[model samples]
Target: MTERPTTTTNAGIPAPSDEFSQSVGPNGPLLLQDHYLIQKMAQFNRERVPERVVHAKGGGAYGVLQITEDVSQFTKAGLFQKGAETDLLLRFSTVAGELGSADSARDPRGFAIKLYTGQGNYDLVGNNTPIFFIRDPQKFSDFIHSQKRRADTHLRDNNMQWDFWTLSPESAHQVTFLMSDRGTPASWRHMNGYGSHTFLWYNADGAKFWVKYHFKTDQGIKNFTGAEADAMKSVDPDHHLRDLRTAIASGDHPAWTLQIQIMPFEDAAEYRFNPFDLTKVWPHGDYPPIDIGKLTLNRNPENYFAEIEQAAFDPANLVPGIGASPDKMLQGRLFSYPDTHRYRIGPNYLQLPVNRPKAPVHSYNKDGPMTYVNSGDPVYAPNSMGGPVADPELWKGESYAVAGEIIRSAYVLHPEDDDYGQPRTLWEKVLSDTDRAHLVANIVGHASAPEVTADMKVRVVEYWRNIAKDLGDHVAKGLAVNGS
Candidate 1:
């Protein structure tokens, strides 16, 4: 037989044996001289990176986004240029959970995407739902805390969640959705995605249009009831993730059709709802979705750690022609996302292969931890040496006039800011009779918990009364029937 080559340590030092570790007197204390054993153990100890504080439990896929229809009149972004095509990565996650949390939990599903466009990487950090619970960024930490387990008790408290919701009436709309069937999506592939915050777009003529993105799943919307979701928790903890992977592996590639609703900049003054409110949504009937492209997830990452785990996306990653809106929540996220990535990954995270922009990136930033690239000429701007120069003429982007005083004040909540219009619309118009019945049942079930005092239940009923009198009456009746 031919001789086999022996394995070696990381330093290219040949190993004497492959099966046994170097020990003193055969099974005594481990010898420090065993460099291979030491290296392996040390590396194993440091294998894990920091997990994300939110959206820790996630599933990702490699894909391509192809523009099927052109909207170049509304935006000059290269991704929307005629017949544009780009590589993409999509991640679906639960908003509140540890890495090992159940995939079928009743929480908002994160629908984030990284589009490697020719100009740069564009990230759409969105959610499966069209709206969120709170409008102000300051309330975010407190809201998340309420959703998490109590610090002292280390137990999930229905009281904590309801207490927060009852105090913040802004949460009623999303709370209604969360307590409905939509909260527990059957699978990530079967749900929709929305760029919940309003954004801005500019054309070649510098005309601006407020925009919202919607990704309707080709698989269609399917969700689980409260009982079904609870049962799924016990049956298969990773049901959604496994279902997505298995479907893709079996040649059933999941896809979402990209659509966008555009509103004229002039209409902000006359809109019924605050266009930038994270707690509300623009009626699709007013500004309907225009088909733009299709996003198809056809490939799986070869290495999860190198690709998915290292992937970073930020709302601040906007190119020329694509811009942000005055949405306060969106503004906060522009700073927060990149800041979190720097802390979780490193200052040079953008240079990582998974996050690096496909287009040439030239900036004044340099010399950080894990420095991967070397600027050949100079890192400073306005240099005499041959370096990247700014092109003002090429800066074709949105330009809007601002005439308001710069003051710290809440957004001008429109006449329809009563927090009941959309929820009532959803109940009466969007949902079927069966869905309405399930929604009432779900709300009543949650409110009937022993921890929820009669006063809290009465408050909840009164709150729902603002949305719908019948809904409030039915919920109260259900609570009474359950002997609340």
Candidate 2:
């Protein structure tokens, strides 16, 4: 009726003054005895969660993945069985951007999905493109650093980005893709996504296969020209996030067709190219994608912080039929995602409702900072107090054989490990004439930014030439740079 109430601290104790801190005297310093003031200051200092190191800026939504075809011959994951449907959440993001970065920038989009399945939670974390910049995990931190701001000037140096890519020759393919129109997708719903790393899928019959995922958009592939994207950056920085929400709210559910390209286990050892390389892609002509399911986003989160920001996806969240391969970056991600979640959220991040498994959780996991439940059962295994034991009979994953030296070294080089040919193919066959022109313009524009050095500009042309002489010459001409 008249007035609501006074503000309180996190502990909910009342009688507070936000205007001034608890001080001994009007002109003196603050007092530590006032727990409320201390709590307020402490909470203010920690109000912001540590943004994700990569994929820091993102938008998330609730969805469902439904099996559209029978793929039981490949794997026995209940989510992939015919006619099966599972609740899911997808978070789309821009890599290397801050939490306030523009959405329409020309960058690789983070496409991470988590499925709450009967067996457990399955995370298919990937990107919009089918290939990556580097194949090793140790270089991951360095690579991301190059794409980020510099220490001295506090600005994103294009010279730094190009230097990293040009030095790491394996980045040719992804760099070419980035400079193309596909990088600035029209909207989150209009672009396709891929699980770029090679994964393993084993069947009930004990046969294993290497698999790659393709989530083709149902809204049709649409992209913005460099000019259009640049103009939109000024107009709407959050266009993608807003479009996704509006479409879902108006009952226009955005969807994708989940496809898979599987290679036989025996063929992987003798394949023409390294099947597990993150920087390369298997030719679709060799192993075509087979449609398997549909993923549709029909719901929006009620609370962005609780549902979207707290959602975590880890490559280590493997199920019975599906597992990981020898992709080095992927191998590193299996450990890093969970560790970061623990640090950013808390030790009990999984206990949050947004991340909890739909299936019953029976573990000896007891109390932590935010643990919601503490069943009065035995807290440890190997006790006569009737604690649950590990069950291997439900869906035991098939066994895989391994033999290698214990020492650390690079993956054995295949005959086609060089980075030139595939990217050349992309320039010649995939990009149309208009697309090629736009690519040249885009490369020139980025290279001519005020921050790039004259030396790095020369290197940029040389890097483009490494992909193809004509493409490189065109970029050089567009930039009006001499052959020096």
lDDT at 191, model 2: 94
TM-score on alpha carbons, each prediction: 0.94, 0.93
The CA lDDT of each predicted structure is 0.86, 0.90
**Best model number under lDDT:** 2
lDDT by residue for model 2 (216-334), tens = 99999999999999888899989999999999999999999999999998988888888888989999999999998999999999988788888888899999898889888899999
Checking candidate 2 for backbone clashes, the offending pairs are none
Q: After superposition, how far is residue 432 of candidate 2 from its true place, in Å?
A: 0.7
Model 2 Cα RMSD, 1 decimal: 2.6
Q: Write the per-residue lDDT of candidate 1 for residues 3-44, one digit (tens) a residue.
A: 997788777888767788888878699889888888878988
Clashes of each: 0, 0
Model 1: ten consecutive residues of lowest lDDT: 392-401
